[model samples]
Structure formats: structure tokens, C-alpha cells
Target: MEIVVSISDMKVTSRAKDVIVTHALGSCLGLAAYDPVAGVAGLIHCLLPLARDSKAPQKNPAMYVNTGVPQMMRAMFGRGATRENLILKAAGCGRMMHISNQFDTGANNFAALQKLLQVNEMHLSAEDVGGTIPRTMRLFADTGRLVISSCGRSWEL
Candidate 1:
């Protein structure tokens, strides 16, 4: 079974048959955490950089990085996962504008993610981020291995 996760959304599962995919992550962020021993995994697709300016974080909560990251962690824990055993990985944060343009979505997105992770005291062990291209992230539950295939290149996360 394959589940598709959209931007600013997250999913966690202990099912061994699950495969999750987040596609076209340009100027966006893709975060995946997995506990191989438990066959549990979670994935989040974040769109914007900051939650500080969003009023929705107080109401919706799941719509922002500040709230969403911890939510994902809890969800994974519910599936019998431990914080120390989670293997973190990320993808995306690609720049969409040309060099002359001032809009640097990729850089800002990366910075925001770093801040969020630092606040939570977590960091990524593997990543394929920052470029002017889109990416497709695939999480295989059977092995707890994340594979990112983008711009004619494939990487093991």
C-alpha cells in the first residue's frame, strides 16, 4: 500500500507493507523519521518556513513546523517508537528562482527547518536538499529505508 502525503501534513505507521511518497517538493521541505527495529515510520511535508507569523498554528496546529514536528514525533511514539532510535532524514528545499531574482525560497526553507530541529534537539542523519529542482521521496516500511529520486538522480536516505 502506498500513501501520498501533501504539504504541511504528516503520517506515521507501524505496518510493514506501507510505502509513503511526497512528490514535487520544490522550495518545500520533506522530513522523514523511522525506527527500523519497530517497523514504524513518519513523514512530514512542510511548505512555508516559519510558524511565528501564522495565526493558524494556534488554531489548526498541524499546519506549521513548530507544532507539526512534535506532532509527528508523538505519532511515531504511539506506534511503539523511541526518540533515541529514530533515524531522521530530509529532502527538498530547492531554489525555484534564478540567480538574479531575490526570492531564495530554498535557503529560507532550510534555515527554518534547522531552527525547528534545533528547538526539538534533533537532527537529520541523511539528506538530499538544496537545488533548483523538484524531488520525489519514497519511504519503504519493510526496510525503514528512505529513497529519494530526483532530477535523474537517486539517493538512499
Candidate 2:
């Protein structure tokens, strides 16, 4: 089964037949985590760097990197994924828009994610980020395989 994780959304599954995916990652981010021993996988797509920076009321925690990444980690652990066994990978964070350097949402998003992971003593095993192109990320629940696709090219992360 293929589970699509939309913008500002997340999905976690332990089913071996499940494949979690997120698409069209421009300034947004696609984060994937898997625990091989537990056969668990998770994916999150975040639109902004932090929830506190948003002017509107925060409805979904998955809308920001600060909240979304931790939420996904907790969800994965709840599904039998352990900290030491978890493998993290990320994609997206591209400079897709013609915005000023100060308003570089993609760079800010990636920085926020890195800080969050560092604070939690976690690190990304692989990442394909920081380009002017969009990307699609996928996580195979059965084998903990993470793949990133961009510009008609796909490769394991």
C-alpha cells in the first residue's frame, strides 16, 4: 500500500506492505525515518521552520519543522521504533521561489530541522537537500529503504 503524506502532514506505519511518500518538495521539507528491527517507518512534510513564527493560530503541529519533526519521532517510537535503531533521512529545502536571501524559507527550514535533531541527540543518516529543484521522498516500511527522486532521477538516500 502507498500512503501519501501531503504538505504539513505526516504518516507512520509498521505494516511491511506500506510505503510512505511525500511529493513536490520545493521550499517545503520531506523527512523520513525508519527502524529496521521494528519494521516501522514514518514521513513528515513541513511547510515552515517554526510554529511560533506563524501569525495565525497553529492548527496542525506538522506544519512547522520544529513541531513536525519531533511529532514524527514520537509517533515512530510509539509504533515500536527505538532511538538507537531509527534511521533518519531528509529531502527538499530547495530555493524554489525568487525570494530574498533573508526570506529563504528552505534554508531556514533545514536549519531548524538540524537544530531539533541535534537537541534530541539524533542525526540524519542521509539527506538530499538545498537545490533549486523539487523532490519526492519515499520510505519503504519493510526494508527501511529511503529514496529521493528529482528531475526524472531517483536514488536511494
**What lDDT tens digits, residue by residue, belong to model 2 across residues 28-59?**
98998889988889999999998885653257
lDDT of 2 at 108: 94
lDDT by candidate, in order shown? 0.81, 0.90
TM-score of each: 0.88, 0.94
Residues 65-108, model 1: lDDT tens digits: 56777788888988889888899898888877545255676677
Each candidate structure's count of clashing pairs = 0, 0
Q: What is residue 33's positional error in candidate 2, in angstroms?
A: 0.3
The most accurate candidate by lDDT is 2
